[model samples]
Target: MPRIELKTEIKANKNIVFDLSRSIDLHKISTEHTNEQAIAGKTNGLIGMNESVTWRAKHFGIYQNLTSKITEFNKPNYFADEMVKGAFKEFKHEHHFAELNEGTLMTDFFIYKSPFGILGKIADKLFLKKYMTQLLTERNRIVKDFAESDKWKEILA
Candidate 1:
């Protein structure tokens, strides 16, 4: 098991930041480089507890499909989604938000287990961890961008 934790300070309301984090549409925009798309279940808009989404994306030049469901949720505060079916042996992404005097503090706690045992550990050491980090960083950047400006209306509206 590996854990990736990131904290992002956003100059926006906590509710807005939280909404942006869970917006399915915003995810697609952030991952356009990988052509990620939600093809089934809650494909668009905000996903609530127990909702699942199946996403198709191209990674490392190979197309892959991943399905995840929101296992826990608390509006404008915390939420968690875990892998239902995907490339990884298991994965859980927890989103946290807290109000700051200046704005909002958004954080991501992503933990995952790879599939190939020792080979997977080697892959993580070699590149997979970094790759996943980059992907999460990009997603947070986009969320921060959207939450900080009126642009969020495009997706959240």
Candidate 2:
């Protein structure tokens, strides 16, 4: 399994940043390059605990579908989602938020394992990890941008 962790500081309310992190619309916008879309289950708006979303997207020139369910959630504090069905053998992503004098501190903890044992390890070492990191970075960038401005209203409203 490979784990990726990232922290982002956003000049916005913790609650707002938390909500933006879980917004389906914001995710699609952030991943526009990959053409990611929520094709089923909570396709729009913010997702809550126990809700699942199935997303279809093109990555590495291959089309893939991934379904994830929110396993844990605490408003303005933390939330975690795990893969229900996807290309990976397993995956879990935890989002944490904390209030700061400047704004909010958002942290992402992601862990995943590929299908094949050794080949998967090779892939992860070669590029999969970096690719996943880029995806998360992009998502966080969008969250920070939206949370810091009025753009969040367009998605949350």
Candidate 3:
């Protein structure tokens, strides 16, 4: 399994940032390049604990569908989503938020086990890990953009 961790500092309220982070609509905006869309289950709005969403997207010239569910949540503080059915053997993403006087600190812990034992390990070292990191970084950038600006109201409302 490979783990990717990232921390972002956003000059926004924790609650607002939290909502933006979990917004299906915002995610669709961020991943427009990949043509990612929520096809079923909690297709829009903020996803809550135990909620699930199936996403269809084009990746590496191929279209794939992945479903993940919010397995754990604590509101503006923390949440974890695990893969229900996807390309990966298994995966879990944990989001953490801490309120600060100046802003909010958001962190993500993404761990996953790829399919195909040895091929997966080699793939991670070659390009899979970097690809996943880039995807997450881009997603987080959009989250930050919305949270730091009034644009957040477009989706959160």
List the global CA lDDT of all models.
Answer: 0.95, 0.95, 0.95
Error of 1 at 109 (Å): 0.5
| Full-model lDDT, candidate 2 | 0.95
* Candidate 2, run of 10 with poorest lDDT: 98-107
lDDT (Cα, tens digit) per residue for candidate 1, span 23-101: 9999999999999999999999999999999999999999999999999999989999999999999999999999887
Candidate 1 TM-score over all chains jointly: 0.98
Q: Model 3 off-target regions past 4 Å?
A: none
Candidate 2 lDDT by residue in tens digits, 74-138: 89899999999999999999999998887999999999999999999999999999999999999
User: Which run of 10 residues does model 1 get worst, by summed lDDT?
Assistant: 98-107
RMSD of each: 0.6, 0.7, 0.7
Model 3 scores worst on lDDT over the 10 consecutive residues at 97-106
